[model samples]
Target: MTNSENLLEIRDLKVYFEVKGGILKRTVGHVKAVDGVNLSIKRGEILGLVGESGCGKTTVGRALLRLIPATEGTVYFNNQNIFKLKPSELKPLRSQMQLVFQDPYSSLDPRSRVGDIVGEGLRVHGVSNRGERHQRVLEALRMVGLQEHHMRRFPHEFSGGQRQRIGIARALVLNPSFIVCDEPVSALDVSIQSQVLNLLKDLQQTLDLTLLFIAHDMSVVEHLCNRVAVMYLGKIVEVADREELFRNPQHPYTQALMSAIPIADPKIKRQRIILQGDPPSPLNPPPGCRFHTRCQEVIDICSQVIPEQIDLGNQHFCACHRRQPVQEAATS
Candidate 1:
């Protein structure tokens, strides 16, 4: 699709943190949290980012909003390079992009009232008119199935699910076009997860909001996202339509991840692919394919050459030597 079709486009995004050690605490190495990730979110679709823990899913989300600095590459939001924007210039754009943090209990201020918590963005963005801001806050709360009475209460008073609703309301109050939902439902109970997921679905449809839903749960991605991107060791291994990825996972890592999903039907059993060895550390990620250490179908070239992203048609993409071996000349 054209650039006009996408609200956010990430090109070669990389986020690295300095790893300091010893008495002097000088930069010894870098933890490559996000390495050369390329992704796009359409105007009104939920794009799920799934991976194992410590794979840098959260780092990508944070980098998009400039919560954390990127070491390299560009994040184009409405065709504007956000990484190049100055602090003052980025302030207004903050309203257009918001984040729903993973833990609701910790995200909200215990000392503040619910109304104040949800309306904090408005206050920051220069909504000085108390009456107007109050109305907007109430409307936002109502949108998330919260009543006005709940607004006066503190964060400690609400249950985990209600606190999450407050967090969602906080994002909505800003009227953001794009939101990075960082495992919004993972902290809640299974029953509450469904409720919050349904709420997010309804809000996305009603507001035409685009989202980057970060999670490790395959079932949740299937339920809420339009497309799925499988990440490993700070790099995206495969990306495809949600249904397409689930039905035919291209990368070995993705296939292994899919195999772990619980099959509801006890009568039908599916083969499980257990990957050997643990994921390599980001500080010194294995050369070439990061999954080479644990990949079941490893080739000699896999250890020496990093795979290029291959377009398998119909917007499906995979980066694996097994899928299509990289030409030696291309790597040079």
Candidate 2:
């Protein structure tokens, strides 16, 4: 509701990559990977970021952690802007924020043992004693449903699920207050995916951690996130509580996405919405409404004017010409 309630607040965030051409390596143009996004993660809540591939969801997560340099905008963690801090100054604060990478196979070092992999963070932050680090590592492993015996083995020795557990263990070892879960379940088997998601939920409650869970699957978001944000072409088209967004998607792009989610029952038939063409390249996005090209409900002004983020009741926000803003809620 206010800045005090938010653990992380993002304002007009933008990340653009320069397109180079010729042997001279001149800047031909820029790919607006993350054009302009406004989001906030409340303390101890899982905010799901869902979108199609190449929609800049991963880019947004990476930019928040400063893994990649941002083109513009600010990220405030605990009311402090992170990009302003120097590397040395930022290093200490980094321990409070961590990332669980998508691919557990490549994320872990194959050459290193699990103990060393998980304990490395503690060592970096100066745990100082071997005994304490070992205990902490074991506790973290146990928390993620892994045993101390497995700690002695290398990444190559473990299964996909086990490796993922190791990765979670590594993040948990830091005792971070905030984490970016970058599709942590996408690489696992369907059955194993639920296990990992449940493990994360358990860890979140146990640790009282704030999470930014990014994924392509709507069902997964519905299961784990408190609120879901739908991204399309570097912009958040809709954001609402999991039930509100899924049940009443306002944006055309979001509706199209929701329609595609397969239903388990054949007894009930649902209308399917098929978009006309692929999303336009980020380097040359549409002048006004990015979705106008593919939107079935497009109006005359849809292609000429940028739609404002109209706040529907109950903190539900959507950008579309057909949706009217609720005067009671804040509009941006």
Cα shift from native, residue 81, model 1 (Å): 0.5
lDDT score for residue 2 of model 2:
38
Write one digit per residue (lDDT tens) for candidate 1, span 1-332.
Answer: 33999999999999999999999999999999999999999989999999999999999999989999999989999999999999999999999999999999899999999999998899999999999999999999999999999989999999999999999999999899999999999999999999999999999999999999999999999999999999999999999998899888989999999887777889878889977878899999999899999999998998999888997866789999888533446547
In candidate 2, which residue ranges exceed 4 Å CA deviation?
328-332
Error of 2 at 245 (Å): 1.1
The true-structure Cα RMSD of candidate 1 reads 3.1
Error of 2 at 99 (Å): 0.5
- Residue pairs whose backbone atoms clash in candidate 1: none
> 293-329, model 2: which lDDT tens digit per residue?
9999989999999887888988899989899988643
**Candidate 2 to truth, TM:** 0.96
